[model samples]
Target: MNFSLVREMMRKDLQEVRKNGYVFYSLLLLPIMLVVISVIDSFAIALSSSGKASMLLPTFSTILVFIPAIITSLIGSTSVILEKNNHSLEPLLATPITDSELFAGKALAPLSIGILLSWLAFTLYMAIMDVLTYGHLGYFLFPTELTLVQMFFLAPVTGMLGTFLTLLVSSKMKDVRAAQQVSALVVLPLLLLIFLPIIASGSDLLINLLAGVGFLIAALAIFFVSVKAFRRETILISWGK
Candidate 1:
């Protein structure tokens, strides 16, 4: 319940994750993968098609959104489920921390890492693309900066939302394998967004704006539900053996 306690918990959890060699390695590796994939796709498309570089740029950039989704959903969900499986939740709940504080601490580490990595990956991707195309790179790479801005701003919000939702679901599901499957399903719509042919052809400003609005609305709804219904009592009732 205490703000200071929540902050300390978050800092410690994140520090522990950092100390884990595999977690550290994966954190470093994921952003580089995003950059590599973006560069490869950008160059391949530039070479293979008659389309102007301007048109293809947005498509390449859109892939950055997936970086956070995959990180949060895959990496974040597994960690949360593991904690529950290991019987760590009971002690965490015994603390003076409120459910929200506990959830916030649990959620912040992965959301922060995932979103930061996603932004870094996108930034690196844009830098590479700019250098290849214009021989110079600056703060802004694209003509209307909305997509770049949206990617930086909204991608992380989505990542946090996705991670928290999965954690909540895992707390209720109890079965780690089933929780992982449900978490994977959470990403299916996002994968569809990435692979959907229409988005790939070129960025649609109208659709992007609408999607952003929809995300905001969905986030607000989830916050209400998380705050109102997410409690130790509720979790125990739903998932306790």
Candidate 2:
């Protein structure tokens, strides 16, 4: 892969995303809103019952983990569809860049943003949980090993899964709305994780390790399938259909 080409494509895509007011603002706002909601929920849980508040952290983290994946799917699908609409995709495909490089470049911007925002949201959540429960718990109550693994490992993998799925769907579908609608389904697995914390009984370490490894494998499988399925010709021919 030509790193230079991938970097250039990523830079160009980032510039375009920044220039689009709606996309840029939504990307900025969604993470903040998610963090705020998480904080409020944490506070509510603390007030309701401090003991249960700690017990619910795993479930809360599981739900919080999906925010970045959701953001990436929305932005990634919109990015590809917008490129097709703007007449930019064909010219980009005509260049010397390989399909892998193109896919990497296209995936990087949203993936990076999603991962970064996911970490930031978690960081804010940890801070809020620590502050709000300090009086009751008398110490920092977050960034448990499980939470750390969820933020750094599971969250990024889930974001990548969402990104690739969105790109694949965007490449196949002509309508941005339809592509986004289908792409939204990619987060279902992550959403399902929320239920695990309810019924799961084990050391936090074991549960997180199992969940992280499972998600990592799923992400790798999706990445390979996406790379194999993505075709510049298919995208070009399918345009405006």
Candidate 3:
């Protein structure tokens, strides 16, 4: 409800995540490594097959979208634990913020970080693919319908769903490790995207569109349910301890 409060909460959450240099830096590593691997794979393809890297698009797109999905869980799982450990959870929950605003604040950091990372990987992957393909085809072969749908629509929704549910689950727990382990399940179903390469080679816009709209609806539903179920008491009084 309060946009300013949500912004402040997001800022504070990000600052806390940054304090743990390892986790924060590791978030950046996934996208970079994915981009590097994609380049190498496409380059090898170009050398052998005369540079039609279109076949690689779907695989990399599936993997790239996953970067945000993974980041969402990492950030959401750690947020409540970090606050509680630093003795900030009580005061954070006590702030003059509504449940909706509090949840928005908590969800925004991971959601935003996930989108940014996915976008970064998409941009870099597309750039390299365009360059490599252009050398032989004399035309860029990117911004495919499936890639766009996955990167812009599905990835963000997946991140939204992951962050909302993961944070809500983590809020009810005390152990950071346990929170992360549980939240990691949110990503398991998404692993099916890796199989997109099969359908991607055909440039299946219909399939991606259906999947994108489906995820959008699912994310919205989970978000509202999480908000309605959110209780500050659960954050600090979980398991009656």
lDDT of each: 0.67, 0.75, 0.75
Evaluated at residue 85, the lDDT of candidate 3 is: 74
Model 3 per-residue lDDT tens digits across residues 1-241: 7799999999987787688699778988989998899778767766786534556545556667667668888777777566777688788778798878988888898889889988999889888888777777776788777788878887887787678767767766668777878777644454445435434544567766676677678778888888876777766776224
- Sort all candidates by TM-score, best to worst: 2, 3, 1
What is candidate 2's lDDT per residue for 1-241, written digit by digit as tens?
8999998888988888789898788788877888787678768867887687777755566556676678778778877667778898888888998878888898988888888888888888888778778899877878787788778887887777778767766767778887777777644454455436623643366766676677677667877788887777777777556
> TM-scores for all candidates?
0.82, 0.88, 0.86
Residue 32's lDDT within candidate 2 is 82
lDDT tens readout by residue for model 1, 44-152: 7766663465666667676676666667766666664565566787787787888788777777777778888887887787777777766322234553465565576
Per-residue lDDT, model 3, residue 181, is 80
**Residue 216 deviation, candidate 2, in Å?**
1.8
Q: What lDDT is reached at residue 74 by model 2?
A: 77
- Name the runs in model 2 displaced over 4 angstroms: 185-203
Candidate 2: deviation at residue 67, Å? 2.0
